[model samples]
Target: MKTSNGRKLSHAALSLTVLGALLGAAPDSHALGTQGACQDNHIPVALAPGLPADQEVFARLCLPPGQTPATVQLLIHGITYSHLHWDFPDPTGHTQRYSYVSAALDAGFATLAMDRIGSGKSSHPPGATVSIDSNAYVVHQVVQALRAGQVAGPSGAVGFQKVVLVGHSYGSFTSWYEASDYRDVDGVILSGVSHTIQLTSPLRVLVPLYPAALDPAFFGQGYDLTYMTTQPGTRYGAFYAPGQADPAVVALDERTKGTVTDTEFSPFAVILARPLDIRVPVLLVNGAEDRIFCGPTLSGTVCSSAEALIAAEKPRLGAQVPCVEAFVLPGAGHDLNTILDAQQWFAVAQSWMTRRIGAGADQTPGCGP
Candidate 1:
């Protein structure tokens, strides 16, 4: 009868912009292709789909250098991408040419990348439940698995050092949840979540205002259709492409429509209540032209918590930004891997992680203006 997917206007705008703006905003467009030379630093680990179900998932571990460190940095992946997404060829999978994982390895830091669980090699958890909480548990188990030698991590640090979880989008939610779940973490990094989180109206409610053309073009042919009839979890993650859902991972978009209350959920919002309780520094990273959050450069900030983090090329509406060190990479979109020299961003990230993990300080403490 009616289309349920909302953001029809924004979707139409972004669909048109995806070709020229999203891909063209960067100066290093050529580097996005294979010609850019993707360098693999070093991530020695195996893939585990998931526990109980025994699905195949992807993960890579980087051992600490000569000296055993005391802390570890866990890199949480964003929506739709596997653990490999942020490392090499970029998390966005926009291109294999630029991989942040490669840069992290080259920088000589201990890190781990994990496939959420079901979307990758891992089997789906029972009840087909893919909630953010479930993803956090998966990350928790994965960390244990890493320590157990099922996956690898910083050597020497062992059980002594703090574990910092860096998350993006849904991945950030996992990290946010991790901060509350685990006690050993040293810090958490949130990018793309400048501030508060607001839930969108359910598809069932939005269908009346549905824009047919926008659905196929925006969500792509297969996913939009599936979501239209099959319901969300049929493919699991609707945040990005279906079937690519990391069984071990979950996003706000994953659960049943309106099942979780906004107060009950929201990674950034979760961080606020326990901001002082966390006792860890948080770094927030975002793109000046982030289409998804900012509504294709549309008015209003991508997130509600714009006050806490330091703003880069935008205005803050009295949010608590000073607490969050915000950085904006010019011209970058949601594509973490394909953005810029990919390696450079990773190098920068490595610096941040290194500083937090006792490797060193971020050469550039500030992000963008």
Candidate 2:
């Protein structure tokens, strides 16, 4: 009896060792693959060589434990933020978190977000012009690096021939630029974008407050820029939010002070010129209350940013871009795309990205009940 028991124990140990080896070799990570845990994924790696002191790169890994895919969507965060905007954070060498990634994971897709050059933990390499094109190049370089080299981060798997490029706000500028410039991008999601404008606005300085309040015609005079020193989130969401931004993103407006913005990057221009000869469809989501991108002018008339942009881009796609779906949910404010209108947004993504990427249509969801 003792001899038999010893032999059984030995076999168990051997089995455990083999399992460990397999886990190590597997391309997916258990840390990030938390089934339905509200966790944000993270990877700290250098995006490029010789980054500046203020910048560093972080790769967000959003893959479930048992499953793995060679290709996944690369999520680009908004301006002044890091990839951490996707999930809840864990203390283990991770910062910044977002809930959107978890939703995507539930949909059976993985996401990887990189810290842009001058933001967060990314190494902001000096001597590099921080324009929309350069930002696009940064993402392009990250994609190439991921493909060229075998980077087995938490996701375990590496090398995506192409990825779904997703961007919001300023990130959309770079994302559209990339989607147009690169062939590997299978699709793109431009959230809160539609029209190109001469946006070097001195008025963007006020946030967590109403820009209309600043326009002399509406509120009657020049308010101090300092009024936006807090409640930036509120300011942004007021015009952009479908709901109230409480404690409201009070970063106090004015994030980009003197950052050399490239006025040349025009969404309308890109669409009209059909610059990238793009073949992939674009999913545009605008918050019903978002005024920054698509809002009513003081003239009391609604100016449709998404409408104007799609109008310009439709001809270029001409059976190639496939479909353009715009969803304006009721009672939902801008920035609500990730929160309030979650269901519709998810459906739009799944349908187009998974089933109807090549089918052209003017399917605009949530324009009503």
Report per-prediction Cα RMSD to one decimal.
13.2, 13.6
- Over 4 Å off in model 2, which ranges? 1-56, 88-98, 155-157, 196-202, 205-242, 246-276, 295-309, 312-320, 337-340, 357-369
lDDT of 2: 0.46
Give me the candidate number with maximum lDDT: 2
lDDT by residue (tens digit), candidate 1, 103-127: 5545554566555643332333332
Q: For residues 120-186, what per-residue lDDT tens digits would candidate 2 score against the true structure?
A: 4454444234456667766776666556534344423355544677776667767767766765566
lDDT of 1 at 182: 59
Stretches off by above 4 angstroms in model 1 are 1-57, 64-70, 90-97, 147-160, 196-277, 295-308, 311-323, 360-369
Best by TM-score: 2
What lDDT score belongs to each candidate, Candidate 1 first? 0.42, 0.46
